[model samples]
Target: MGTKIVAVYENGVLRPKKKLNLPAGTEVELIIRPSLKGLIKLFEGVEVKKDAESALNETRERKLWE
Candidate 1:
């Protein structure tokens, strides 16, 4: 298998399944099709969570994202 992507389904599974076979170190882009709930979940904590720079004390942590 070449970079197995976690398949997702809501009430019913999506069709058109395919397989991939590649050599070692073969990097590939994954086109994941997340369900509506799954897509919303990805933004759950991220959207509400405070920015690390604003939440973290300057003396307490070093932020790479800032």
Candidate 2:
């Protein structure tokens, strides 16, 4: 895991931004930490319920295809 790969924490999982050449079920240690932007986003305050609800109700899916 020496190669640093950036991933986005979407929903409740880390989605890698690039293709990985690893096999399935590979047990690797993960150092879960927030990026600078993510740390700053924490102070963005509560999102509006209407906006949040609308976003959640959308039909579009989020996929990690890089």
Candidate 3:
């Protein structure tokens, strides 16, 4: 399982906003990515007639035989 935490980059180190459960000297991998709020705003003005759930169900039904 993987854990997700928000962190801030300071002078040089990345500081986690919350405390972690890991012990001292434990090595962990980091996957840095920006928030999606900004990306979502890019399509704010767009409109769609079909909801995601309905479209996903339609696609799944079509591929059921294959």
Candidate 4:
């Protein structure tokens, strides 16, 4: 997912954006780098969120801390 770069836009022009057959209400994350080619990368935020949520849930369930 980290390696996926969905779009590349430049100088008011947009590159070929990727196509996805996704379900509604899907959440995505974008990394925008304006200093270099206006580079942009899209990621599946759901995956990251799921991991974080599980991690937090586990800690809460066990009352553990580092």
Candidate 5:
């Protein structure tokens, strides 16, 4: 079974927001994914050359309907 938890990286360590129910010295794999809020903040105030509809139409014309 796999568990999903939110964690923060601090001082070269990953600190889990909540305590885990695992024994000491337990090994687990980590798959890191940024949160939605984090992604939004990452691209905040970024400029775009074209609107969404225009971009989609261009993509359809070049890729789908070509």
Candidate 6:
């Protein structure tokens, strides 16, 4: 199962903003990408979450069949 979640890189670790549905000790990989603050601002007053989720879902689907 693949999913995307937000986190903060603090000190020397990445802290998730919310609880995750992963089993204990389940090793996970990290693909760090910089935050797009400017793009977000350009879409100000719009629903950013839905757009981001859609983009991620599309990418995941494409990668799954690759």
Highest-scoring model, TM-score: 5
Better of 4 and 5 by TM-score: 5
Worst 10 residues of 3 by lDDT: 34-43
Flag regions of model 2 displaced more than 4 Å: 44-66
Q: Best lDDT goes to which candidate? A: 5
TM-score of each: 0.24, 0.52, 0.53, 0.29, 0.69, 0.52
| Model 6 ranges off by over 4 Å | 38-66
Per-residue lDDT for 34-65 in model 1, tens only?
56666567446654356767644541464322
- Cα lDDT tens digits, model 4, 1-66, are 554555667799645377656678977666654333321222223243467778568646864332
Candidate 2 lDDT score relative to the true structure: 0.66
Candidate 3's C-alpha runs over 4 A off are 37-66
Candidate 1: list runs displaced more than 4 Å.
Answer: 1-32, 48-66
Better of 1 and 6 by TM-score: 6
On residues 1-66, what C-alpha lDDT tens digit does candidate 2 reach at each position? 277789987799988999888899877777776676865575367454577566445413432111
Q: Arrange candidates by lDDT, highest first: which order?
A: 5, 3, 6, 2, 4, 1
Q: On a 0 to 1 TM-score scale, where does candidate 3 land against the true structure? A: 0.53
5 against 6, candidate with superior lDDT: 5
Residues 1-66 of candidate 3: C-alpha lDDT, one tens digit per residue = 899998888899999989999999999999876556643664477555699897557646966322
What local lDDT score does residue 30 receive in model 2, on the 0 to 100 scale?
A: 78
Question: What's the count of clashing pairs in each model shown?
Answer: 0, 0, 0, 0, 0, 0
**Reference-based lDDT, each prediction:** 0.52, 0.66, 0.74, 0.53, 0.78, 0.72
